[model samples]
Target: MSAGTPERTPTPGQPRRASVPEFGHGMVVGKFYPPHAGHHALIAAAAARCATVTVVVAPSRRESIPLDLRLDWLREVHADTPWVRFVGRYDDHPVDYADPAIWDAHCVVFREAVGPGPVDAVFSSEAYGAELAHRFDAVPVAVDPDRRTVPVSGTAVRADPAGSWRFLSPPVRAWFVRRVVVVGAESTGTTTMAAALAAHYGTSWVPEYGRELTAHKLARLRERSPGASVFDVRWDSDDFRAVVREQQAAEDAAARSSGPLLICDTDARATAVWEERYLGSASPQVRAAARRPALYLLTDDRGVPFDDDGLRDGEHLRSWMTERFRAELAGSGVPVVELTGSHTARLARAVEACDALLAAGWSLADPIATPHTN
Candidate 1:
């Protein structure tokens, strides 16, 4: 299992890669926090040797990404491999492999998940694999414990996910989403630009949920009172605040389901503009939920037609709101991508911004701060 464990050696001159555990049924166990490329290589090494392999997905409560989401990533990566299967056990058990008491508890969990089996071999990249395999009555096969085969680690990926994007799976990459928010005054082609970017990138987009809610609420109000005008209805900051929460939830869910990048029609950063127009001032929750985007494309509403959707304050107010959004984003540390000219030109500019963002990634020395201010 380790350097001096009397294990079979790999082929001569190929020290980086390990030989497969030439056995019938192999087992691998790991927390698979984000299921990176190294995890995939480890599973593949086991799959190469055995007729079948069981991958136990162990997750603790303290993980930033939820257990279910991590499991989802594992399933997505290894599901198509005929020889690989997945099992899981989420518990608060200690992960201290060096401690005998902790190892005993882990053995009990592993025994239950593995069930009754000969367990021809146990595969891992840790020194503890020797003891774990001994408990299972199987030979321990260590695969690239030095991590030379796959250089990336889960901790490194978590720290600067965008910089280490190649190691992550598509599903897990969703968690490290470089959210690009297209926001500005109403009728400025925000929806169109967001959709175009998503389509270009072959990913999903988070539509403006607050606007959708506004349309729904207005429709119901009109249904109840047929001849009532906009002044007949009265709403408060609490209503918009609730909409911000919904928008945030929608964006989070979309991020889970989307690809490497998530395109947002608008996020909490723009909720202030809406709240200010209707409710005098923005809600505190809006600033709280606002996140720093990888890139913010502020639509100028230049040559675009200004049409009211029954909820807007008309074109006359669009310029002022645009200025307000610009002011709100001016001092924020997030990178801004100003869009002008035709729709095609705007889309091109947005695509260019995303390409640059993904290419450069976040520098360790400086990070854009998500300001929690009005």
Candidate 2:
């Protein structure tokens, strides 16, 4: 049942035999588009009954997510299930369930791909799938089409991504939530670096969640005190504290909504850094809002170009800014990987550092030294 062994072919004159459990093989086919809770339930159920489970992931044109992303989602969700094997539906074979010949051909290809083993059963959701399994001479284990018992489907999960994410198993949710929040200080290329990291890793990047919170707080303040100054409204009010909490929740929600990874432009810690530096001290609530990131990426101020975003203090003060932020972070005992060089060079270094950290079994919270390459 392991990946490399060859399957035994039945003799030409012999009858097709019912697969023996001793041979230890099973095949499960589904679209598995992002592999929601229902898919996991079915796979786990099937895996319990069989010695080996070959998951045939059929590509769907209607779904927006890429095939590889779906596969990664499956891998992340089923990391503990060593008996599970993954394979793509053959491109040469048609996906239509009505085509019995095509299904048979796909079965042959799957059997060959997994090495020669007697396939004892086929686990699926659709009626057409049951028919195809019968045609392949395997016992058809039909998963509930409505998934009413499991009560989660990929379509419904996709429709309300954030809300429906609670339906996923804990491991899947954890994997997703950790991949998003990329935190850094102002003028350290948080926005640029977030976008670049997302592109490099092929994942979604959430823009600064705090912007909306800030805007909302400003709006509420304007309503309360029409003539208040921008600083007075933002810095000297309870509204700022509310905005900080709101921003943190939004970032966590964004992480739960997407898979692969979500690169966040800034986090609550970045907001706190500015609040303390400019306002002398953050409000008690704002101070409480500042929390350590899953992975803290510190960028050195090597005089990278800065644009006037109305909020930027310009490149001249970057060294001072970097020093203050570094001191603030150091006191918290949170480890940081300081990225240096040109923007592109820094980004490349960050990626390498992250990869190495992950390879060495370090999670986001674990402190790791930033690697420097000549």
Candidate 3:
């Protein structure tokens, strides 16, 4: 009789509830907008009484933070909790917070996603929380520690993140402070690829860190430094260092989240390659920063048809850039998994390589395969 064992019981006009000993497997559903302290307390309480906890992260029409970011927030808070699992709501059917039908659908989806288990209870604070419990044939435990009396909502948090964050747990707050950056040459599909990988892996990504910094620099130059002479960005400038540092910091933060893995399109190594090629020499600090990547992916210049993004500097330049990147990586003695050929082929190859590497005992913390079709 472990503390978290499941319990069972029969109910009138409802699905049979498992006996007390069968309540070990529990399911919790919430927006967890930022997974505040209150949310953590609820989850901890549930964990104490359950062998396993499944968290259902449902999308709120009232909240704007993407589902992926919210998922990241949760992972960061419960990184060490092995018994905890996460699932996002399906986009097709909107679940009505007050509808038992919706809750029934959600429970079915949850069961399918997590597989058959001895779930005997549902932990929630929604208006129909009890109904959901009945529909799922589980005991309902509602804890409204926030005093809001309404659902502990992500919408409320998004309205005033700083103010409402007090409702979130400390772990959620820490996730906000952490950042995840995706970097690569223009038109290298860094942004798209980063988004895709994040979605596939269920993590968060920091938007282009360099673009924001560059925009800020451009704005500052337009204002106080209006007449400042435009210098080639390659010249040693504090601006360049600031951008590099920002990008590096973002990547580091993303890596620390509870998500099983975080994927970055680019790393400090890519930046160093750019600086060395454009500025003639990379700063020692930048060179040192480049070594922080847990794994390096060198995309091959396999004549993948190029699109005119204006920012892309032709295939010839890309070929040269690829060569330089290889040379730099060689000098640093960092092993790189090179991906070449058509994008479709390359992606497939990458998946295979990753599967093989994972099988061989490589750390699953980083990308190890580049899928490329011949």
Candidate 4:
């Protein structure tokens, strides 16, 4: 249900600092491509002075981030303010601040979403704030016109997410976090690489859910039959499905709290390879669960000693598994870096790959251009 502070009326001759609001209804409209801290502060300032505030989170259809996702993040960030309302509409109309026809076309979309009203105040920080307020026949209240308070913008964020990381809320950060997955054959140092990368970056890492599932199976078998071994554990299509679901859920949860980069031990695509090892074929469902990560670090089995961790397969299967992983990942579009040699050397190479990815920065398509006018 839509939630916000209850609508209220200004009391007659009340003190300015009292509970009474300055305006009956206030409106805040913007593209909110990603809704950074500056956007939040503007809405907060409006909510403080108005009895009720309506925020229109409008973005063009060509934008990468879905419109509903933008609205969801804005609502989550402002959930505590019950008097503030957030609505979304696709404003695909061309942006030409000086053109009256373009302004009228855009205002029509905003007005329909805000409902029939007396919008007493139009709160904004854009150059068109004065004209927008005049169209609504409301007072124009500018907040942080010079961008000194928050010191961030959607364009700046889209250009360099890591630099503007602090300006993004948790949900927005989760969407921006770069996921780096480490995958390899048994005893090929996948876990070690993932943990080391997380430590080097001081970020959160997700452990292999498939390993936890394997241990659980072994423990359960031991409970039924005394001294059960890893070999006794059974495999089924459902087991791989569980791994994919749990792995994805864990990665998503970690992304919200992780640093600029998130390290993952093994992802769904690796699980599909493991499924092929045991079942001779990868299930359709398991293959579908594979998602594209920012980068993939495949720890080559060569030169790495096989250490049976009580849950790993025999040493002979390591070479076959490594080859299978290589063949499968070849067609995957994401960048894959094969880590070989000593642990130290592989870690150094992995670090270089991660640094390069972050350095490249994000590439978001430009929004409708508002030509500069003198």
Query: Best candidate per lDDT, number?
Result: 4
Sequence-dependent TM-score of model 3: 0.44
Candidate lDDT scores, in order, read 0.74, 0.59, 0.54, 0.85
lDDT of 4 by residue, 113-173 (tens): 9999789999997878889999999999998887897777887878777877777777887
TM-score of each: 0.62, 0.48, 0.44, 0.90
Better of 1 and 4 by TM-score: 4
When 2 and 3 are scored with TM-score, the better candidate is: 2
- Roughly what TM-score does model 4 have, to 2 decimal places? 0.90
lDDT value, residue 294 of candidate 3:
36
Clashes of 4: 4
Off by over 4 Å in 2: 1-40, 43-171, 179-185, 212-234, 237-239, 313-317, 360-374
**Candidate 2, TM-score vs. the true structure?**
0.48
lDDT of 2 at 314: 36
Local distance difference test, candidate 3: 0.54
Error of 1 at 373 (Å): 42
